[model samples]
Target: MRRLMKLGAFALVLGLLWSCQDSNEGQQPQLEEVPDEVLAQVANLGFNADEVKMYDGVLFIEGDIRITLDQLEKMSPSDGLPVEEHYHTDNLVTGTPRTINVYVQNMPQKYVDATDIAIDRYNDESLNLTFNRVSSSGQADITIRASPWYYYWFGILGSAGFPENGDPYGTILMTRGYYDNVSNINGLATTIAHEMGHCIGFRHTDYMDRSYSCGGSPDDEGDGGVGANHIPGTPTGPSANSWMLACGSPEGDRPFTADDKTALGYVY
Candidate 1:
């Protein structure tokens, strides 16, 4: 999660996200304890490299991205975030007319409906891949679940991973308990859509320097070994209204901009 924001209540950043996982276990076992050497390795691949945390056996970086040592061990680092608008990762769902099954569970009914709206946002477009909301996990190419209870207390809205092996990232974790506190169901839908973007390999529109939106020193979250290649037709520079910006405000609803549609069509 790059960060989240409170709905006009002093703007508590609910969060932003990206994720990865692997079988290379015990690379660092202590919960909540991340070693400097590991941080160095993570930094080498191009991430924030600051305040990396271990929670529930997963490495959470840049607020909500989950990455494992296995991916770091295997991936070849790519160039920094490009000075462009929408971008996609090197990995993608390669086949034509692909159906990405999405399942949402353990969340509110409003959220469930919002998921549909998010799905609709994409389905309305004419991309090679289509997102279908499945009723069960067995049929899902991507599953969205409520994050751990503590995540709500931690101000995390949602998290997801980039694509790998020509397949979409498998899961999304949305924070629980903020359903009512955060007004605007469409804003929530925006967050869900953004996570879906990640699972399908989209990077933050402001990836060149997250601080452009999140407000900090210009942090190039790096390629993190997975690759962040710029889309050919998107406008060059940060898109303030792009749904995939590194951080977002709680008050606004971020539908995909024209450039965003171009990026989706270009990559898919």
Candidate 2:
């Protein structure tokens, strides 16, 4: 199954994938251009290295998740998960209230507003995580920027990375066509919150099987050695309407469902 209109966190790279099309390698060209070392490293992490691609001089997996060479070289691997539960990465922002300052660059007004909506949804919760959008990029801990290029493929929504060293992933790159393609601000807000979920260490609620949310084929987004540890207290069965599902639809409007809150609270 392909993760539709999904994005990811940075830590996933040297370690794993943070994307909308988690298991389905996108139809984008230039797979041949990605270096063998990149492919080998991605493969080592349990991703589909054969589907890896190069975009705008950056290595991307699944679709838009960036994998830096420096990070690749420094990455270490591991494994071991709870029998059944929600998932998150090993590295997470540390604190009772992990307040993340967000900044947007060149995003449409709709997306800017959607970011606020998503942030509010997170802040309203009693979890340890909180997001506050800053007017200046310099004042932010995470900067969300619009991709320089427009969307030419079907599921090209956005991309990101996982948290590292007790800090939220540094940046989130929204595909330029996202605002235009999604049906409403909440859909965009869902996408925004989803990517942030990766930054703060949340994995897809359906990580074990992308086909659960995204149809096509059943695929597991492997742990990538970073650990997709199950969050305690979350359901062992499917979580309906979670913002962190592997994919987002054009009209999708999921906003912090009850189980999502449980996952957030359990992790933080």
Candidate 3:
């Protein structure tokens, strides 16, 4: 009986050791270090490392902004681009309330898809935003114009919305080629998001954060302003992969981040 008891105790100790080994083997892998370029992008976007968190390996980030169309329009466009003359119109000017007309000149399907995605981003209730095919006589609030080459350059360009001044914001011209490629051939969703961001009052930036990127720097008053830049959600980039700035990165694509969703909530 004493020998049997000793054997039982030895077996129990071995079982516990084996269980511990199995548990260690099943543990999730540790995260790899973030690359410097990604860190730089995160820093530029205005996110702190402490503000970023990872869940199931994906990063989540949130930002708060109070920008308006008036703020964007008052800012100047990029220098190489032609000066944009401001115009004004109202949703009630023609007795139609809250109706904003969009004329899609080329790449109709892509434009439609973009509208769908944009609406989805806004939870299917984008305010005062509507679309139609091109019309010669109908005074439209926005128009999209593009060519195959232009599409190759930038998926979409220009945007029209009711600025604070209240004139039917003029046309948002897009390169048909980029839209076609992005929609059918290339299927590049990031540029579409970027252009839509422009439509909704966002701009390009090497930085992704507003505070960290713009900290101590004078507020950017140009077309590619600081307010429109993205904010970081991960030590690597804005949320693990952001559709806004990732298109231009070595990773070559960025989906949407929580920061983007937050900004959309503000705009939509």
Candidates in order: C-alpha RMSD to true structure = 6.4, 7.4, 21.0
Which sections of candidate 1 miss by over 4 Å? Answer: 1-3, 6-31, 78-85, 224-228
- Model 2 agreement with the true structure over 170-267: per-residue lDDT tens digits: 88877554345555777777778877877776666665666677665776766556555566777765577677676656457888877787777777
**Superposition error at 228 for model 1 (Å):** 5.0
lDDT for model 2 comes to: 0.64
Residue-level lDDT for 224 in candidate 3: 27
Expressed as tens digits, the lDDT of each residue in 1-268 for candidate 1 is 2234422222153322212222134243344677787788777766667757666656666665666767655655553322223665455666878999999876668778878989999998878888999898899988988766545434455677767777888988876544445577788788888788877767677766777877757778665554556677776578768888877765468988988888888877
Q: lDDT rank, highest first?
A: 1, 2, 3
| Candidate 3 regions with alpha-carbon error over 4 angstroms | 1-99, 123-139, 147-169, 177-179, 183-190, 205-240, 246-256
Tens digits of lDDT, candidate 3, 131-232: 333355266555555422211211112222323333333444443322232323213334444444434334333233323332343332222222322222
Q: How many backbone clashes does candidate 2 have?
A: 14
**Poorest stretch of ten by lDDT in candidate 3:** 82-91
